[model samples]
Target: MSATQTRTGSCLCEANKFTVKGDPMLFVVCHCMNCKKQTGTAFMSNVMFKEENVDITGCQDVGQYADSNNKSGSTILRHFCNKCGSTMFGKPDETRKTGVVYIPSVLIDGSDAWTPTKEVFAEKKCSFVKELVINSPQ
Candidate 1:
């Protein structure tokens, strides 16, 4: 078996915990309407890891909801903590074959390492929010 790379994360209430391994294939900031509604913010920062490299413990206490759809016509799976209602992660159905896992920055201990390389749906970004040098998907 391949050795798993480990990165620790937790939910707002600390009720849910997880460890993600392997290099993230894509790191992005989503500014789509669905992302704004789900996060209640201008955008969502996400780091995609291979599902096989993720080991989630304490997830039994977590709540999952299927909300919205992606451009690929796939359902988005959102996982959060029931107690605190913290938005944890979003799973895009299109990347299921690659074991893709989207991890929210809030859960990460050292989130500075996961800076977004690009932004999606910038056309709908909040007017008050200024983006950095990250490229936006047209």
Candidate 2:
């Protein structure tokens, strides 16, 4: 595919570069405990796209962490760049056949057009998180 047809991005150290064609089919903010720890923040901004649309053209040090306690009851394969330790995306273990590449929004190159249209695992969200939105004047 032509470079202009895709969005290109890389890990913090630029050791791993990737490209995704087209916008995500789904965008979400996850507040599950695992998300907090995975992102080292209150929540994680995720952009889910069809797996075949994404291409990690360069990377030999991709690391993976299989999470067994996921709410979906399916093992979550969290993939990241081992060089800079940047958490990139995730996929449900082969058995689920979800075919979705759950990528961290910040890792996707381009503008800030992406926004979470949904939030999941709200019960696990920190109390302060609600205040930020509720207290907003919007």
Candidate 3:
């Protein structure tokens, strides 16, 4: 959890990998329909960080899709590993303009240690899901 520590992560096939420098800027759980469909799960845990802090290797194996069916009415560029079809990260054009990247927590190794600071689209949360109580340091 050191401020300057670098964290490494890879896709299911290990064909695509990345290293993120420093701590994450934000950690959020999203219950949006888009997230559920994209991840094929109830919700998605997104760990956000400045793009400058992330270094991705195996760019050639990474593919992207333009998601235009989001609730926020913005097209999100979703990146994934072509080899294993593992979704890696997303870049909302607006957020990308500001140099921010939202990586799926499941794709980041050791991300379970990070607590969710916020939850989005709670109205769409599943009935069996329990809300998380987080105490953010900031």
TM-score of each: 0.83, 0.87, 0.91
Q: What are the lDDT scores of the predictions, listed in order?
A: 0.74, 0.80, 0.85
| lDDT tens digits by residue: candidate 3, 1-138 | 888899898888988889898778898889999889888989988889998888885456988899988887788999988888888888876644768888988777888788888899999999988868764766
C-alpha-based local distance difference test score of model 3: 0.85
Cα lDDT over the full model 1: 0.74
Off by over 4 Å in 1: 1-5, 69-71, 93-98, 135-138
Compare the candidates by lDDT and give the number of the best one: 3
Compared with the true structure, model 1 gives a TM-score of 0.83
Q: Kindly report the root-mean-square deviation of model 2 from the true structure over all alpha carbons.
A: 4.3
Better of 1 and 2 by TM-score: 2
Candidate 1 lDDT score at position 134: 65
Range of the 10 consecutive residues with the lowest summed lDDT in candidate 2: 129-138
* Candidate 2 lDDT over residue span 30-138, tens digit each: 8898888988999888888898888976756799999988677779999888888899778988888888998888887772666566787888888788722211113
